[model samples]
Target: MGSVEVPSRHKALVYDSPGKISTKIEEIDTPKPGVGEVLVNLTHTGVCHSDMGVMCNSWAWLPAPTAQGQVGGHEGVGVVASLGPGTENSNVKVGDRVGIKWIASACGNCEPCLVGADANCTSAKISGYYTPGTFQQFALAPAHYVTPIPDSLASDMAAPMLCGGVTVYSALRKSGAKPGDWVVIPGAGGGLGHLALQIGARGMGFRMIGIDMGEKEQLVKDCGAEKFLNLANYSRDDEGTKKLVEDVKAITGGPGVAAVVVCTASNVAYAQGLSFLKFRGTLVCVGVPEGPSVPIATANPAAMLAQELRIVGSAVGNRQDAKETLDMAARGVVKTHFEVQPMDKLTEVFERMDKGKLQGRVVLDLSG
Candidate 1:
């Protein structure tokens, strides 16, 4: 590929004080790639709930709250504008369309890396959190770690797949449900949930039961969900949880679902997730709740002993997962529903997200 000119400075959205709703569009020095790194001129990025969590200091497991002036965004798709010294050996050249994900870089020497679980690496660098993120037009990513975007997938569609799509794909793989088995996905109309529904039904051939608000009924069904349950119809008391479990039982003919993937951050979803699973069933936890939410109801030994339920927590997917997810999108088995908005409207998008009004993902046009 031919060399491209790069500017010394670029526009970026930065958090003035993490945990507070303060952000600014500032012009910052454009970062140059180092050895083993490539400079990506990001054209589009997906705004994720995790980005909000980082800015709001919501997650407890983070090493620390995101520092001030941190550039926060992980779901980015762009072309390589320049290659750094020594990156020639990496086989990633300038002009290649690539993607940056939540796991920015991981130490290859770590145990998790050796086991192909780089997302859990002990010394992993997180994009938009510990390291610089893709919110800006220009960002640096390790050549070995950046995902190669498939030519068939558009940049906006590919952005959310880098994180939300890969995440649910990993969770569905971990769910242990075979083709024709019933898999229940709570919060099935949101960004991650909608992708999970399509992947489960179309990609894996599993029967999908999507649970979400009433407004998302059409979307969930259109994505191939065999059954849709609206949580808005149920109360939040013990009776509501009982009704949800009963609804699952009814849909699955009393044996209950083979797997339950809770993709919502609401603790109420977690509290009732295991109840929807059959005996020896698996409940995969993907969404994380913040603050004073109660823990999962099936955490006790009695519940485990009686049901033999397996609870698994999944982080962002690895490189292999990213490749497979993009391939699925390329094949038309899974597609994201998103609105392309200019970068300046990100704060307003966040406000809409906070109100639980966003139907699907929101992709920011970085070039604007």
Candidate 2:
């Protein structure tokens, strides 16, 4: 590693208002990492749907809407530019390649942190939400919390894994479906779902059934799904639900799938997800619907009792999950379909995302 020039100011995407897509690139003072922190000169950052949620203030469950003027991005990949006055014990040094995730910093002394569930820490700092995020060219990250990106993985691909990959990886792990089990991933062509399909199929040895529109059939198949279900072919009524359930059962050899990971924010996806699960099956919820949308239709206790099903909610993954996901990417077991774009084109990307036109993830090239 070699010494690099440090800039006094850097360009950043600043949120202009709380509940809209108003952002402007402004030159802000570059921050110096305090004790126990390192400054990362970010090369690429993935534009995630959650970033849209924060910028728009759509989710009511958050502690509060994202404050105005906050920089919004969590999946940032870059090289360390400098280290703070830590007196040298953090095991991280200048020039090391690292990545920052959704969970910026968590108190390790908390109960959840002690058990390696730092995402649920009592006092956790969220990057791009409550703290300064990766939308800027340089950002400060906690030394112990930032993940080291492998040399084999390119920064553009590694950026999305820091959030979408690790998230769905953790969700699948929590689903408890073993190798050879039939696991279905709805919205299997989107950012998180596509990575989940690859990780579950190639890396974890599970047989994947990807459900999405007809247009994503090839993408889902290319990502290693054994079967692809085009949701557009089915109706949203009771008959459509029954047809989908029967289709899944037939694909799984007369029994329902062992688990179903719902990776889309569509309420209809959630309403139809439980029908794909087998007895004693698990349903892992990874995507959050905006506002007070329709609740899950299978939330009734009677239905849960009859099927012996388990429903679990998963937030963004922990550090271990991040490492494992990046390792999988480095080993070529999984890969992200992304297009690199200049930072100024972010608004157009968001428009595509809102219209359900994006095929996969989009990585922003901050250098431009």
Off by over 4 Å in 1: none
C-alpha positional error of residue 236 in candidate 1 after TM-score superposition, expressed in Å: 0.6
Flag regions of model 2 displaced more than 4 Å: none
State the RMSD for candidate 2.
1.1
Query: Relative to the true structure, how large is the alpha-carbon lDDT of every model?
Result: 0.91, 0.90
lDDT per residue (tens digit) for residues 41-87 in model 1: 99999999888888889888787878999999999999899988888
TM-scores for candidates 1 onward, in order = 0.98, 0.98
Model 2 clash pairs are none
How much does each candidate deviate from the true structure in C-alpha RMSD?
Answer: 1.1, 1.1
Candidate 2 per-residue lDDT, tens place, 188-248, comes to: 9999899999999998899999999888889999999999999888998989989998999
